[model samples]
Target: MRFLLIVFMGGGLGSIARYLVNKWVGGTLTSVYPYGTFLVNIIGCFLIGFLIFFTQRAGASTIFWRLFLVTGFCGGFTTFSSFTFENVELIGNQQLLLFFVYATGSVVLGLLATYLGILAARNI
Candidate 1:
């Protein structure tokens, strides 16, 4: 019950943060690109990687933090479904070039961000 509550709280916070980021990015960029989802996914990936490494290196029981931050928060924050849907829409609208760029860039950048996060955690 305690664990569930912790995850629930973290997820709620993450969802709210995601919503705010989407609103801000959408308002700033008037384009067909899914910048909001891309940003959140990459950020979430980095955060998960960082937290995982930091917690592991600390040599402590971080099950609660992992569940809250990684499983709950990051899970709520990242929008894989939206990303896929946007890609489909792009394809249906014949935006193949944009679709490919967005998809490829998100994947490549997300991986890079995760790696950077791991490095950052290790250094800290």
Candidate 2:
């Protein structure tokens, strides 16, 4: 019960943050690309990487933080499902070039962001 509540709180916060980012990005950019979801996913990956390494370096179990931040928050914040759906929509609309760019860029940039986050955490 306690663990559930902690995850619930973290997930709620993450979801809210995701919503705000979507709104802000949507308002700022009017394009076929799913920039909002792409940005959120990359950011989530970076955050999870940083938190995992940082917590491990702290030399404590920190299970609660992991559950809340990594599992709950990141699970809620990242939108891989939405990313796939958007890709499908692009394909349906015959935007093959944009689809490939978005898909490949998201994957590559997300990995790079995670690696950078890990390096940042380690250096700190």
Candidate 3:
């Protein structure tokens, strides 16, 4: 029950953050389709990788923080849930090409975006 609560809280935070990013970025990003989503995914990816190393070095989060940051925050922030749902709809409609485009585009652009985010953060 406690674990569940942790995840729920974290997810809520993640989801809200994701929403804010989307709202801010909107269609005006003017670089890359779904640039906001791409940006979020990239940021999420960078954090995940960084967390991997940091957690390993000084021990990881307590169960609660893990659930909050990893499950909730990262989960909410990225919106792969929505991404999956949309992808499923595309696939169901037999829009295989679009599905592939969405999938590959999401991955490639997402990765680049994340790397950029990490690079910027590191430099800063």
**35-116 per-residue lDDT for model 1 (tens digits):** 9988988787677767667878866688888778866787678756346556877998999999999999999999999999
Candidate 3 residues 1-124, lDDT tens each? 8888887888888888888888889855765588788878878776655544465565644556656776677777775654665677799899999999999999999999999999999998
Q: What is the C-alpha lDDT of each candidate?
A: 0.82, 0.83, 0.76
**Model 3 regions more than 4 Å off:** 27-32, 79-124
Top-down TM-score ranking: 2, 1, 3
Highest lDDT scorer: 2
Candidate 3 matches the true fold with a TM-score of: 0.56
Give the per-residue lDDT of model 2 (tens digit) for 1-124. 9999888888888899899999999999999999998899888867876766777786667888977887678768875534665687799899999999999999999999999999999999
Residue 55 lDDT, candidate 2, scale 0-100 = 73
| Candidate 1 ranges beyond 4 A from true positions | 79-124
Candidate 1 local accuracy as lDDT?
Answer: 0.82
Residue 124 lDDT in candidate 2: 100
How far in Å is the alpha carbon of 63 misplaced in model 1? 1.9
